[model samples]
Target: MIEPETVIICLRAAMLGAGAVCFGAGSAALLLAPPQVASVLRAYLQPVLRGAAGVLAVAALVSLAVQTADASEDWSQAISPSALFMFATTTHAGRTSSARALLAVVSALCILLARGNRIALLRLGSLTAGLFLASFAFSGHAAMHDEPTRTLQEANHIAHVLSGTFWTGALVALFCAAIILLRRPSGDQVEGAELMLRRFSPAGVTAVVIVGLTGALNTWLILGRAPLDRGSIYQLLLAAKIAAVAVMLGLALANRFYFLPRATRPAALVASIAIECALGALVIALVAVFGTLEPV
Candidate 1:
């Protein structure tokens, strides 16, 4: 049987990953897409954003309870008001998780109440989603350090997560747009989609670069050495995560260089991007596992 802690970690990762997809996709649409294209994307994305944020809020609360129980090593304490209060009030992870839950709630409400207001979605929704992601920095491995190192680790973690989410989430948006365009073929829509892809290429490249750099820095900071120990579960998971990322990079390169140039073959483009999204999901799962493990 899987441990409750592991289950909660997976739950947190899934919710946070889905939330990132909304955030990155929305932000990319606002920044990279033409007004008409963005409007259409928004029509598809807003519902997802609301749903993911709502789920994230609920998952955060549920995870908080599970974490409290795990921390207290007494399953009954999961529902004990005093234990819950102490955990939420006293622990770094508890405070951060609480903040994340609040941010997720606010994000959901902003999208729900905005009700087609682009400005509010862009401002309030993005602000809350960004904060939700940033909350992870205050918990987990990043928060375990002292003094200036803690600040440095936290900032690096934020950059790492933001860039990673942007990369994976934008791929999700691109895949959705590709599928829709393929279904309802249009010259203008194709042109807009192509333009969006063009705009995303450079940004995606930059985000991936940051993810690599900051990820390496984070690993070094956490393990205090290179991650080469195959004997340890944490190291093995880390290696698997790295391999998945490398495969993603290869797929991205193929999309950028091979499939993208042949714009007429959008089926091929769609296939490649879909694969990237799948791999991105895999990476999130791997991170969820390794993130909960102690490095060797």
Candidate 2:
């Protein structure tokens, strides 16, 4: 049976993970997508980002309350002004959660009401998204280690998250493009879609490579030379997450090397991308659970 605290953590992780994905999609549109494709993608991404940021802000506040309650060992103290203040100012976890909440609100406002040129808005969104991703490291397993190991673990985790989010988010963006522009598209739309794929390839490939390399480094840093105990729940969940990622990678490769070059079957391309997004969602769900578990 899952504990209440575990459930809260899982919920928070899911919300934050989802928000990160949305942010990644916006960033990918701004950075990797062509202007023609990006303009269309933003129409789909803006409201999603706004909703995600709002969710993330709420999750951060709830997480902060939960952490305070745990630290005080009194449920009522979750809202006690003195207790909350002490926790927020004195504890690392509390400080991080507060920062996360603040950033989430800022990101949401930026997305919803900030008036700027297209480039300015995109730049603002990217900055907020990167900062949001960085906050996750402080509250994660990486913070448990000592000295240089902690710093290295944090860096590795951040890289892993950035790359994974970028890769998965780009897949989502690609799916949207396929749906909007590729179904009985005009000649120019078809050409734009193809150009989007070509532009995405380099960044997508790099993100995949970073995710794999950093994930390996993170596992090693966390567990050291100890063999993974198959009997442990943590190990089992970890294994499952890895397997999901591996399958995602395979799908990505197929899309890049096979379907992408052919470009004739819009339906096939859309189907493949949808499948990858589904797998990515699975991986995020697994992460929400295993990430809260202790490694043996």
Candidate 3:
């Protein structure tokens, strides 16, 4: 017997995780252009970025549907094969279910509108990233609660999430893009692949800084104090998240100053990004659980 609250909470957790992936990957794709082009990045880079964003977007919408089903009694009871086949939904459907579903459809349409414009697709993907990032405010412990400075806290929370999403999502997608671009022996393409890694490395470093600073500011507002004073589950999660992110940074630094300058093949780039993705997924899992916990 999954209660509506429990179901909704679970969906919100998955949504936060998936949304982080979307925002991170989409931003990486968008920013890769100017710098990577000069460095002679592989041809398949843009398409892989778009594909990763598309996949992450779909995951987010699926989570939204789960929440919708839980919120709506009609949707909840008959949601198996029959209702889905009939496209039936519940009357108690949440406002966010409707809005997020609409956003998912719109974001999908936006991707189709891009067609084959690598540059446009890259930028458009980043904009869709913005949509999922906003989903955080409408759900979770933050939604519909009363407080002395709720508005200010929500605003700060949004910034914290957006900045972290862009930073984290971009790194995850960049790794995927690397894998797609690096497949097979790249005897001729080695130079371009290496160039892409080198160019994007600095940007990754910068995004880490932004994620940390914005996240710290957001926490100060949300907790009404620094990490030491805040005693909520969310605060504890924040501490863990900071530590995980620190480890991720160490990995990125290793990739940058150690392997990248001389990484001579598409396979090496692909493998390196794969390792990064594994680490990133671990961080996102923490974020998923974090988003579900109470702030106070």
Candidate 4:
């Protein structure tokens, strides 16, 4: 028989993955385009986000199946394997919707930014993201109570999640944009692309800083400021997530300092984009770990 703890762990992982993917994709898609074009791009998100959503959807359904079976029967053997799949599927769907909502609004603001009004887009996106993320924490089991500590932790956690998503999404969008410019080689678009790239760099830097601040805040609230002689699992997980993020930042810095400015070779650019995507996937997976880990 499958262990209850195993099931719980997997369900949490699925939740984290769905949340991160949805939010990240939303931010990146919106950031990649100008206000108007971003609106249109919303309709054409890449299959990775969709596919992940689908998989998580199935997983949620599967979880529901197991829970239902257990509830009706022994509360142990209630949900069959198939039912568990359904649980994961449905849960993933909700998570994906939350993310897509955030992304959609960002895309809407894309049009405004495209018209050379980025401050407007940032303000709009940030405001929208806050509302959506609040909806996010309460949407699940975490909303069961309204205790003060939990309320604060929940808010901080939500901020951490949103900031991470924004950071990763922007990176993905920029990476994709880089690939497009390298392959297409259009003189008319070159200047525009270059300007966008420059704009993206500072944005990336900002995201990294925000990520650090939010993450530190989350840690302080979640784990008290007691020094540990050795690393616990949460610490280990946080370290892994942070390392992954640092590597990604390094790559971005390399691109900005070395490749992007020089208009590096197409081969080099493609390589960097692929690396960015791979690292992003790693970051997403690591984020899943962060969610599951205990604060203490």
TM-score of each: 0.93, 0.90, 0.71, 0.66
Q: TM-score of predicted model 2?
A: 0.90
TM-score-better candidate, 1 vs 4: 1
**Number of the top candidate by lDDT?**
1
> RMSDs, each prediction?
1.9, 2.3, 5.1, 7.3
Q: Give all candidates' CA lDDT scores.
A: 0.79, 0.74, 0.58, 0.55
**Candidate 2 lDDT tens digits, 119-192:** 67556755676687667788768688998778888888888878887787667678877676557446766676
**Runs in model 3 lying further than 4 Å from the true structure:** 34-93, 112-115, 118-122, 141-148, 176-188, 225-236, 265-272
Off by over 4 Å in 1: 117-119
Off by over 4 Å in 4: 7-15, 34-45, 59-147, 189-192, 226-231
Greater TM-score among 2 and 3 belongs to 2
Cα lDDT tens digits, model 3, 181-274, are 5563444444444555566767776767767776776666556676553556776767777777877777778777765655545466556667
* Residue 86 of model 2, lDDT score: 88
lDDT of 2 at 126: 55
Worst 10-residue stretch by lDDT in candidate 2? 114-123
Give one digit per residue, the lDDT tens place, for model 1 in 194-295.
788778888999999999999999999998877788788988888888898999999999988898788776798899998998888888887887887787
Our tally of clashes for model 4 stands at 35
Please, what are the lDDT tens digits per residue for candidate 4 over residues 1-296?
Answer: 76544564565456445444445654566555654334323433454445444444454445454445543444444445554444434665434443534444453343324333344553454344444444445543334346886787677667666776666655555555566567654554555455556767666777678778867766666565532424677676666766777888888888788888777464576577678767766766665555555555
TM-score: which is higher, 1 or 2?
A: 1
